[model samples]
Target: MRLINLKPSRTNQLILALLPFLALLLAYALGSTARLAENPSDKLLPALSSIADAVNRLAFVPDPRTGEYLLWSDTLASLGRLCSALGISTLIALVFGMVVGMFPYARALLAPFFAAVSMVPPLALLPILFIVMGLGETSKITLIVIGVAPIMIRDLALKVMELPREQTVKAETLGGNSWQIALRVVLPQILPRLLTCLRLQLGPAWLFLIAAEAISADSGLGYRIFLVRRYLSMDVIFPYVIWITLLAVLTNVLIDLVRIRVFPWSELDKAS
Candidate 1:
């Protein structure tokens, strides 16, 4: 069979999906063993046992000073900022995307501006945000919004513009006004794409959030990682990084599920 036509069975697919992760774990274990054998005081590539201990301390044990589980607290703080910023970004994208996609004059005025804005690196604006908004949750959340919103806006706008022109014409033929057509037609068609855009932006959104948190924040996964780095706490840092990855993966999965549940027709559209 040609490579293009070859497909794995479900069991083979599952095994293939797991192979890379298993290899990664095995490599880390071997590296850690070798490093520790050479130098028992090695701080890098900590053994899995040490990582487990750190996870227990961070996730299960409460801090002596703060009396709160560090991992859970950090997760909450990071997620609060992430969700708030993404929510704001989604609203902004939906409104502006629709306006730009549906109205030529609005598109002429705003599309180029947003397209340029999206090109600017979000991290470069971190200092400005901190100086202007101050080193608070607001600045962190704003950084994430600034990083992800413009791209999302552009993506959603393109999706809206790509929608079949015939749908709008049919709506107009039914005597639907501009507002009616937008409300009944454009919004529904672009919502699935909106979710997809949000999904695509999640990684950048997390990057911006972590950058902001590392630079200025009292509590967050990023802050904790940076705080511990002074002492070369690889065990803690490693688990925190893994925890962040797991969270992002969970979020991506949840978003896909919600999209499938809410917009089953989008899947059918894709199949066709």
Candidate 2:
């Protein structure tokens, strides 16, 4: 059999998917054991047990000062900022992307400006945003939008431009006006790609959110991580990092499921 034709069975695929994570856990355990054996006071590479203890303290136990579960509070704050920014980004992308892709005059007017804006580093603008918007949720959410929206706009615009020209012509032949063609044709075709562009922006959105939170915020996963670094609290930091990863993964899965459920034809397009 050709090498490319040798596909794994479902069981084998599941095992293959798990192997890397298992190896990573095993390596961390061994490293933690070795480090602790040499120095019981080691702060780095904390034992798995210590990580579990930190998770319990942060997640299950209420904070003495605030009387709230720290992990849950931080998660909520971070997610609130993330979701708000992403929602704004999606709306901006959809509106501007369609205008640019469908109308030549709009494309000529705005495309170059957005391209230039996208090139500027979003983090560099963080200080400016804080100075202008102040160190509040607004600044943090704005930072995420600035970092993610332009790229999404460009991606969705390009996807719109790539759509078959024939379809537009056919719609016009059916006596559809500009708005009617856009509503009945371009909008439906680009929606799946919009979700896809949003998916691709998730990692960058998280990065921008974390950066903004680390620099200025009262509560968030990123803020907590930076707050503990002063004491070299690896156990807390490691678990928080893992929790963030799990949250991002869960969100990605949910978005994919929505895309599949709402736009089953997108999957068929891919298969063809």
Candidate 3:
């Protein structure tokens, strides 16, 4: 039987867009049941509601210690460390991936190795990475690189090489040199797709940063999670989980702005 291609219906469109919301709703419902299973007396919604009130105590309620509200400093410090690791990931991914993608032989040699390595849990390498780089900024930043760079470089390289050969031949025929062909023609075509790649990579890189910080750092979001566990402070760590998600959203939106600006042609095609 032959399958016919058709556009999505209104219901499908609505469901696709609302999919994440639906899944989260389902998860929360199931999670609430699971919590009740663990301890029947602990009603999930009321407990969450109580925690919400307690968070307000940071400003509204007085602290028992100095009679002042407990303002959070750990959150800010954790965010700073996250930003540092993220910065390292972006720079390394772009430079390393860009070069590898543009060169065929280099891509051939390194692409498979990277793909295989990426499949291995990046966290699994933390012990060795720590041993080699130490438990300072080096180990954490190095972990981010190992996690992000391989995939980024591979995608960027493939996208660059994916340009229509006819365009390259056309440019060469018009007296454009190798460098000129790459810069004027190849760069623009690939840059749009690369922007998409960059946006996608940002989330994963930041995710890895959290684990990297958690494993060894004395500070950062990961460190705060550890501290919270030590103190049985669940609420403090939970809010930062929300913060990480919000940061990813904001970063993706920023990249989306660049996509609109730098790749008007791609946007136009998408519109069509």
User: How does each model score on TM-score?
Assistant: 0.98, 0.98, 0.72
Which candidate, 1 or 3, would have the higher lDDT against the true structure?
A: 1
Which runs in model 2 stand beyond 4 Å of their true positions? 1-3
The TM-score that candidate 1 achieves is 0.98
Worst 10-residue stretch by lDDT in candidate 3?
A: 42-51
Report clash pairs, candidate 1.
none
Superposed by TM-score, candidate 1 places the C-alpha of residue 224 at a distance from the truth, in angstroms, of 0.7
The per-candidate count of clashes, in order, stands at 0, 0, 3
lDDT of 1 by residue, 1-272 (tens): 89999999999999999999999999999999999999999999999999999999999999999999999999999999999999999999999999999999999999999999999998998889889989989989999999999998898889888989898899999999999988999999889889888898999999998888888889999999999999999999999999999999999999999999999999998999
Task: TM-score for candidate 2, please give it.
Answer: 0.98
Candidate 3: give the clashing pairs: 78-220, 97-153, 101-157
Which digits, one per residue and each the tens of the lDDT, describe model 2 over residues 167-199?
A: 889888999999998898999988988888888
For residues 69-116, write the lDDT of model 3, one tens digit per residue: 433544465556556766665566555565566666867887788778
Model 1's lDDT to the true fold?
0.94
